[model samples]
Every structure is written in C-alpha cells, then in structure tokens.
Target: MSLFNVFDISGTAMSAQSVRLNTTASNLSNANSVSSSIDQTYRARHPVFAAEMNRATANMDDKASVGVKVLGVVESDKPLTVEYNPNHPMADKDGYIYKPNVNVMEEMANMISASRSYQTNIQIADSAKKMLSRTLRLGQ
Candidate 1:
C-alpha cells in the first residue's frame, strides 16, 4: 500500500462513521415516537458496513483492502415496544400504543462510539499530514 493510501482509508472510515452517527441520531430522534398501529410504528435504523478492496498489483495473489464501505441502512428486526395506554391519544382500537424498537441507551452508546471513531480518523489524517510536511522540510 502507498503511504498516501492512509488518507484514503481514514477518509472512507470517517465517512462510514458519519453515516453511522446519522443513523444513530435518526434512531434516537424517533425513539419516543408512538403509533396507533404496528405498521405505522418507527423502527431503529442501523448502518451496514463492509471493507472495500483494491487490486494492489497485476499479480493475482496480491490484494489490498482500501477502506470502509457502507452497504446500506437497515431497520432492526427486534420487536417494537407495546404499551397498554388506553388514555394515550394515539392508542388503537385495542387500546395499545406502539413505540419504536430503539433503545435510548444503546443509541447513546452508538453515538459516542461513532463520534470517537470519527475523531480517531481525523487524528490519523492529521498525523499523515504532519509526516508529509516533515518529509518536505527534510528535502528543503
């Protein structure tokens, strides 16, 4: 891998983390949303990630992983929260309201993790910049 590939890898990683953070934020924002029917209830959304690969050389045996790739966003399959709140304005004919499957604590943790990951990537890019600058200075 080339030394400059570091920036590409870290940049893609940061983009993936941004997607993660966005999905986490959307999940958190809809965490409290209620619906009168199961079909109308919101579900927690999560991002799917995969590693992007590149052909390092003409040699068939040589391959290099370039960076992170976002496969897609998917909704959690976990069951939604069902509450027996007949008094609630959104209650259905069965007097039950449906809440999103999003867990606030889990979403909060995801937010923190994504943020830290983004920050780490930024630090990595900064380090690479500093290294390149020092190399240029050495040539001066």
Candidate 2:
C-alpha cells in the first residue's frame, strides 16, 4: 500500500470510531429511560463496521490495506428490564415498567474503547504526515 493510503485508512477509522462513540453516548443517555411496555423501551444501539479493501489491493497476494465502513447501527436483541413499580406513572396495568436494555457500565467501557481507537488513528495519521514531510525535505 502507498504511504498516502495511511491517511485514508486513519480517516475512515476515525469516522467509524466517531459513530461508535455517538451510539455509545446515545445508549448511555437513555440508559435509565423507562417505558410502559417492553416494546416501547429503548434498546442499546451499536454501530456495525466492515473493512473495505481497495480495488487495486484485491488482486495482490500480500497483505491488503483496508478502510472502515459503517454497515449500520443495530439495536441489542437482549430483553429489556422489567421492574415492578406500582407507583410509577408510566407503569403498566400490571404494575410493571420497562427499562432500556442499555447497561451503563458496558456503555462506559465501549466509550473508552472508542476514544482510544480514535486516538490511535490520529497518531497513525500524524506519523504518516511526518514521514511524508521528511521524505519531501530529502529532495530539497
């Protein structure tokens, strides 16, 4: 892969991580939200990513450089939490309230991971820029 491709790779990685962070934030924001029914409760959402190989790299037998692509965001299939709260205004007729499936601890971990990934990608791009600048200086 060309040195310039590093920027593209890092850019895509940053974008993907941004989406991940956004989803994690959204999940955390709604973590405590309650609904009258399970169907109305918010489910934790996560971004799905896929590696996109450059067309030129397809035929190469060596390691292929790839960028990231967000396939989509998917809601967790895990069941929502059902709590018995007879006094709650949103409680159902059965004296139960449904909470979002989002887990605060898990969302915090995901946020940290996404932040680190974004930082790593920034470092990669910075290194690539430095290498490119030094290479150009050599010709002067």
What tens digits encode model 1's per-residue C-alpha lDDT throughout 8-38? 8999999999999999999999999999999
Off by more than 4 A, model 1: 54-65
TM-score of each: 0.92, 0.93
Candidate 1: residue 45 Cα off by (Å): 0.5
lDDT of 1 at 86: 96
Q: Which run of 10 residues does model 2 get worst, by summed lDDT? A: 55-64
Model 2 bad stretches (over 4 Å): 54-64
Q: How accurate is candidate 2 locally (lDDT)?
A: 0.92
Clashes of each: 0, 0
The models' CA-based lDDT, in order, is 0.90, 0.92
Question: How many angstroms is residue 74 displaced in model 2 relative to the true structure, after the best TM-score fit?
Answer: 0.4
Q: How accurate is candidate 1 locally (lDDT)?
A: 0.90
- For candidate 2, give the lDDT of residue 14: 100
Residues 9-83, model 2: lDDT tens digits: 899899999999999999999998989987788999999998885543684775556889999999999988999
